[model samples]
Target chain A: MRGAGNRYVFWAVALAAALAAPLALTNNYQLGVAHQALIFALLATGYNLLLGFTGLVSFGHIALFAIGAYASAILVVTFGAPFLVGVGAAAIIAGLVGVVIAMPALRIKGHYLTLLTLALGEVIRLLIRSMESLTHGSQGFSGIPRPEIFGMSFRAGVPLYYLLLFALVLGVAFVWRIEATRYGRAFKAVRDSEIGAEVCGVRTDHVKVLAFGVSAVFAGVAGSLYAHTMRFISPEFFSLGLTITLLAMVLIGGRGTVIGPIVGAILLISLPEWLRFVKDYYLILFGLAIWLCAIALPDGLAGAAARLLQARNSVRGRASLRT
Target chain B: MVELLSVRDVGKTFGGLKALDGVSFGLAKGEVLGLVGPNGSGKSTMINVLSGVYRPDGGDVRLDGRSLVGAKPSAIAAAGLSRTFQNLQIFGGLSVRENVLVGRDCRLRSGMLGGVFGLGGSLREEREAKSLAADLLEKVGLARFVDAPPSMLSYGQRRLLEVARALAADPKVLMLDEPCAGQSQAEADALAVLIRALAKTGIAVIVIEHNMRFVMNLVDRIVALNFGRKIAEGTPEAIRGDEAVIEAYLGRRGHAERR
Candidate 1:
């Protein structure tokens, strides 16, 4: 298929899948799993901004996500603020922290930068855990309010699912818009070659810092939604594992492509849950899957699939010539 | 003629090695100056220091008589100085159009949120940039390759794209490091014509090159260096006949001036 044909097929499949998902998932328990998968989709898209487009693999993106969630949760539960205000606050807090982190981290590159971001994320998590008085620490924060639209609270599983879907759509559209602009060009330039980007008069440092700030805002917004959807907040939920899973999603989806992260998140998040039947060896299978995916397809599943399609077409041409 | 860029006694040392020892030169508007030197002659290092990759250990640099000694690379770029690298640092993964658009970083009027929100002005700016990029690609004779990625192009084509990328900045002064280093004689001759044309448009050009025949034919003035020091500066014909430059070339065959 060409151009819009592939898009039409993709959307048709996506809509069909979305519609069929709720039918198969009859209980709230299954719905919760679906909701978490959607949340991961949002976070994975944000993570890809740094890891894929900008070529900056950050291991501490979860810090920004947690910061956003905590900020919004505290504002709504403790201060009686509006839900939208909490969302805005989450973005601001995450962006501010992102800038702080970028200031020092931007000076470094490659694995060292990754290590620095990981350590920073751990520090933020530890700080949240130690702030027993403010954050409720180990006990966590509960009673976080649901998002209110037109004075109606999204309290149930189905309503929450649609709300999160709307968030995902808006987030995806935002990413789409950015990918077409000069900012996206700058980010890709930095990703491909820092020295080349600089010589071309790109302010690489500014591009990098801006990418981190934007990625943080997305992650923060996702965190706010995650908190409200769960109606609870805790340090345990914002673990390094979530960051690792999101990173895996980005790599599995094809980092620089639009739908890659979403596909990655949905598949990776749901596959482990589905393997619950093999409860004892579920993790072993998960680990094997990740290893297999990495070894067989370094560009991720989306990349591998595209290559396979191309290869098949080429082989068809060769066979036709031989005949 | 008005001086567009002036380097006054700029010097740098990496520990014990004095890569640049009190180098000074000035470029006037629309002038084409050639920097020629031997191996370890500090040609590339001089470009690096002037372009803000390396801070000068002594003295200062001035663009339009404004001090730029301690400015960062980005700040220097924003001040209207743009350059190309010897190694052809074009983004291999991006299309030629996208690479050229990156050159317009300082010229972009869009804000971060403006792009994110798809504001009217930002979108308009983007459309304008696309057309501008097309024009730049045409000027560099890479119009057909606009949609093609840099990796698909030949080395000579990549060099032209690198020049085009610098031109996309719409800079007041263009500092090209060995723009013709790896091209054939025919390509080098074409580049000389392009360089001359660019200089005629009032963009001061400082070209560091090894092709003596090309530089001698195109540049108005020649600045030569040997062992991190300025050895000769005069008209191209005068430097072509200079014994010091001849000796430096003899000292390192194909290495010093090639890169």
Candidate 2:
């Protein structure tokens, strides 16, 4: 917490491991799963900006993600827009919607905001299902191509996985660098106490809107990535259950830290595959894990790990002082 | 003397309970005013109104001749008024320095995009805010605890931390609500010295204290309130002997204990 050099080394090692992941994946299916993990990692990292830093419990987040996916699919499949343009448009569209969602936040507080967001999310999903001409209704949107940037095709799983990894890396770096900035501090202050932040000259209304907008942009990009990689997206996939999973990824992994959601995303995404032996009951195990984590690691795995690391460092420092 | 803050006939009602009824006062630059009142006499409500925590149902609050009646607490802070709560509201998730940096957030011109890119302008601004945080913490004698969390600080030390954070906004007017509450005598004396030094720098301060000894010695003027009305306003000596003030205190069960 005191700006240790070890923190940088820790992240550097994590980055190196991420770079080498596809090499160890061995098969296209495994690499495809890695791609999903990276996309969700990006999504959860953005969600952390709101849930972990801003202290907003908005259930409408996945609705933004759904919008991003559908927007990209429509632009690419129907209108013949380039993949990059689709992604950019998706982010902008979702970000605008996010700001609209944040408007209700200015007048509401606590459980009221949460309930309003829940209602709003459900409405968006219902709308997506009803809009048959654009979204293909509940039947789903399919056949979206993988990214083709600057004439370089990423049709292969290995190449697509690297593309996704690149995005997640960029996102994690942004969150990391932003933490030292004044806006980042403002975000945390609002989380701690809205009135306190307001009293200290922080324009909390702008901060909330910013948090929502920025995080929604992330959701949009991740949704675009998810649509392209999976080559399919349906209104059903963007349900309240998906929102709960996203929340679990941030909460059980660590809410506030940059590395927390990535860890959570990777763990949650792969845990089901790893628990194939349990078959259908894997969900029960997953539920129990989340419940136990809520009770045992209130700060999440990253927070607990940071505490352990800090304690060890202090212990060593004291030992060295005696010598 | 030019009044930095003027509260004129301000009133607030909570479910037919008139918390502040026509309360009026003016604070001059560099003067420390003590707001003394028995419980439920609207002391907190007065602070809340001036700081924009509540909208006055009647009357107006002006800072530097600008109407601030319906402005948000954040806007009021940007207009050069900052405050600390009676109950500590420090950010537990942030380091001591970051907590103070948040106070200067309005003045910093960095956006989320600038922050994400580690852009040169925002980086420079971030460094400037860091040093500002450091300077404020050192001024409040919390330099050693800059990187530590506020949760680690003692209750008295946390009070000083809050003061440092409030000052980080560089406000021309400050409101401290029960700053000496739960503090030891030595800690309270240290705070008194800090407050006097702050007032000397031309910042008008409103100190709401029930500690008669601290209030009598520290403030340039005293305003006594009873039943949401200003019963007395004058020098500390005058208010100490004012018949209405004596009765206002005597009627309360904690009068002898406070005095």
Which candidate has the highest DockQ of all? Answer: 2
Instruction: Give TM-scores of the second chain, every candidate.
Output: 0.93, 0.95
What i-RMS does each candidate reach, in Å? Answer: 1.5, 0.9
TM-score of 1: 0.92
lDDT of candidate 2 at residue B160, scale 0 to 100: 84
Model 1 local distance difference test score: 0.85
> What is every candidate's C-alpha DockQ against the true complex, given to 2 decimals?
0.58, 0.81
lDDT tens digits, residue span A202-228, model 1 = 788888898899889988999898889
Estimated TM-score for each candidate:
0.92, 0.97
Q: Provide the clashing-pair count of each candidate structure.
A: 0, 0
Candidate 1 residue spans exceeding 4 A from truth: A1-5, A8-16, A306-323, B251-259
Which prediction has the highest lDDT against the true structure?
Answer: 2
* lDDT on C-alpha atoms for all candidate structures: 0.85, 0.91
Q: How far off is residue B129 in model 2, in Å?
A: 1.6
